[model samples]
Target: MPSRTPSSALYKVAFLWNLFWGVPLLLAPSLASSALGLPQPAPGLGELHARAGGLAIVLFGWVYLTIGGNPRAFRPFLPIAIVAKAAFFLLVAFVCFFHRELLAMLATAVGDLAFGALFYRDWRAVR
Candidate 1:
């Protein structure tokens, strides 16, 4: 096989991070259901969250491992991912708003914004 570039190594590392963190989140719904004796979500909802979370993890890995070290290529995806993350947080905000779940709302909103800031810094550094 051809040799991997430094950028590729960076991407691989990022991918591994996602893969490592994502597995648990992927299993969380089922674990929650079983461990907490909570009713399980409909199969569709469970599948959807699993798929989305899995996709996010994979995407994060791809970006981190492949593009992270190559600022030029990585630059383009940064804004898009930030926006997507923001939207995700907004969705969480809406859920919390509707449900009046103060803690969840605070956590999601703050966490997402913090993540966005971190991404922004990374992007700027790369630039």
Candidate 2:
């Protein structure tokens, strides 16, 4: 087994962060919404959409876990992961700009932003 680097540790943290949001959102959308300080969505379509989003987050966490397990082998994914994190932050920021009530999501946005920056740093170091 290869020794873990700080970058690998960061990917593990990212995986955990995604789980923090993903699992609850997947299992209980209304509860997750309330926890995140957002209005609870109606059942059916609203809940379905929320669940879908949760699934996507979980998928991303899987990618992070893979990278964390073997950063050198997953080198090509580093840039893609950074972009995915940036895109998520930007999307959340855009939505929050128009809807102040959604500001609670800022923490998640910021988390992605920080992870993106850290990933960029690691990518630079390797190159």
What do the candidate models score in CA lDDT, each in turn? 0.59, 0.88
TM-score for candidate 1, residues paired by index: 0.60
Per-residue lDDT of candidate 2, residues 1-127 (tens digit) = 4433545778889999999989999999999999888988778999999999999999998898898787777879999989999999999999999999999998899999999998887776663
In model 1, residue pairs whose N, Cα or C atoms come closer than 3 Å (at least 3 residues apart or on different chains), thus clashing, are: 10-65, 11-64, 11-65, 11-66, 12-65, 15-61
Clashes of 2: 0
Error (Å) of candidate 2 at residue 70 is 1.6
Model number with the top lDDT: 2
In angstroms, the error of model 2 at 9 is: 1.3
List runs of model 1 lying over 4 Å from the truth: 1-21, 32-39, 101-109
lDDT of 2: 0.88
In candidate 2 the C-alpha lDDT for residue 35 amounts to: 88
